[model samples]
Target: MNGAVSPLMQLLSEVETLKKQIAESEDPVLKESVGSTINAIVAYGQEAYSEMTQILDEFETFQKMEGLTEEQRNSLLAQSLDHFKDQMSDHEKDSFAKSCEDEYKGIWESLDGDSQEFLSTARYLGYALRMRGRGNYAPVINEMCRVFENELKKKIYNDYIVQMTQKQVVDMDSNTEPIKTAVSKKKKNKDYFISDTEMVCFIEALPSVKNNQSGYLSELKKYLQAEKWDIQKLSDSQYTKSAHNYIDNYRNDSAHANLMDEKKAEKCDRQTHKIIKHFIESKK
Candidate 1:
C-alpha cells in the first residue's frame, strides 16, 4: 500500500487528537484553544468539526471491505476523505447563502416579504457574520458600516425617487429645489450626502400634535409626494445612534487596524448584528 497521505487530513487528524486529549486533560487553556480552532473551521457553518469525525469513521469502515486490495482500500480511503471534504466545502457555501435568508432572526418576523428580500440581499451582513465566525473582526466592522450607508441610500432612492420622473423630481415642488441646487452648485460637483445625524434632526422636525406643516418631513411630503416611512426608525434611537457611531468609530481605521481578540470581536459582532437587524426593521 502507498504510504502517501494528504497534508490536510494529517492536520485535521492532529486537531481532532489534540482536541480529544485536551478534553480529558483538565487544562482550561488548552481546551479553550481547541474550541477556538473548531470555531475557525466552522466559519462557513456549524458541524464542520463533527464532519471530520464522520469522515474518519466512514473511511475506517470502507477500509475493512473484503473485495478491494489493500492498495485500493488506501487509495479509496483518501478519495472518500477528499469527497467528504468537498461535500463539506459545498455545504459551507450553501449554509452561507441560506443564512442570508434568516440569520437576523431578531427582526425577520417584523419585516414584510419585500423588506425581508431587500435585507437578505444586502449581503454585507452575511459577509460580516462569516468574518466574525472565522475570528476576523476587521471585515465585520466594514460590513456594519456598509449596512448603514447602503440601506440609507436604498431607503431614500426607492421611497422617493422611484415615484417621480426626472422632470417631476425637479419641477414638482419647492422642497426638491434646495436638493437640486445643492447637487448642481456644490464644489467638486459633489452630490448631496445623506447622514445619520441629519436623519436624527429631520425626524425631530417631523410634525407632531403641535406642528403639522413646517418641517423636513412636511416639505419632503410636499415636493417629492413621498409617503412617510417607519419614521420612528429614522429617529435618534439606541440602535440608530450606535450604528452611526460604529461607522464613525471604525469604518475609516478598520482596514489598517490590528486584529482584535475574541472579546473585542464578540462585541463588534454583536454591534454589527444590532445594526443589521435595526436596518431590517427600519425598512419600509
Candidate 2:
C-alpha cells in the first residue's frame, strides 16, 4: 500500500503514526504532551508547504526569454570575460573576480545570446536580491532596471570626452594647431560617493520616526527638504524640518521629466525609503 503513496499521503501517514504512538504511551501526561506536540508539528508542516507552493508559483512568473540558445549564451559569456581579461595584466587579478566571472560564464553557457539584453536586465535583479536578501520584488526589479539603464546612458555620455582624449587621433600638444577642437566635457556635479561614516552619522541623527506609513514618507521628506545636500554635512545631525510637498513637487516638475518613467519613479521612491531606513538603523 505504501509503494504508491503520494507525498501528502506519506506525511499524513507519518502524522497518524505519531498520533498512535502518543495514544499508546503508558504515562497519561506524557501521552497528552506528545499528542499536542505532534499536532503542532503537522500544522507547522502544512503551513510551510503552503508557503513553499506560493513561492514556486511566484518564481514561475519571472519574465522568460525566447529563442535563446546555450551556445549563444556561452559565446556572450566568453566575449564579456575576454574583454575584461584583456584589460588585466595577470591571471591572479582576473581570478580575484572569479565569482563574478564564473557566474556570468555559467549563465551564458546555460542560455543563448538572442536574450543579450538580459545581461543588463539581470543586473538589478541580482543586485536587489543581494540588497534585500531574497524576497518578492517583481515591480521593484522592473523599476531598478529602468533606473540602471538611465544611469548607464548618462555614464556613456559622461565618458565620451575621456574616450576621445585617449584616442591616438587626438592632439595633446598645445603648440600645434589641432585638426579638431578640444572638447571640454562638463563634470557632472552629483553626490554619489557619500562616505559610510557620514551615512552612519546621518542614520544616527534621524528623528524618531515610527517605521510605518508616516515613517517612510517622513524620511523621504527629509531628503527632499535638504537644503545643500552636501556630503560633508550629511554626517552632522541638524534640526531642519523641510517640506515633503516641495520635494514631491520637484519630483513632478518638467525639469526632471526626462528621468520620470513610471518604473524609475517607483524605484527612486523605494531607494529613498531605504536610505531613510538605513539612516535610522545606523543611528541606533
Best candidate, lDDT:
1
Residue-wise lDDT of candidate 1 within 36-135, one digit each (tens)? 8766654523454455446544544664476764335434544543444254334343443355445566665554444333333223323322423544
Candidate 2 local lDDT, 1-284, one digit each (tens): 00112233345557778788876789888888877877776896576445544432333232232353433332333343233223323432333333323444433232222222333233323332333244433332332222222222232222433343444443343422211232222223331222122223233334443334232223322442442233223233431112122123222231221223344444544443333332222221
TM-score of each: 0.44, 0.21
> What residue runs in model 1 are displaced by over 4 Å at the alpha carbon?
1-91, 100-102, 106-136, 158-228, 236-239, 255-259
Best by TM-score: 1
In order, the Cα lDDT scores of the candidates are: 0.46, 0.34
Worst 10 residues of 2 by lDDT: 250-259
Say what the RMSD of model 1 is. 18.1
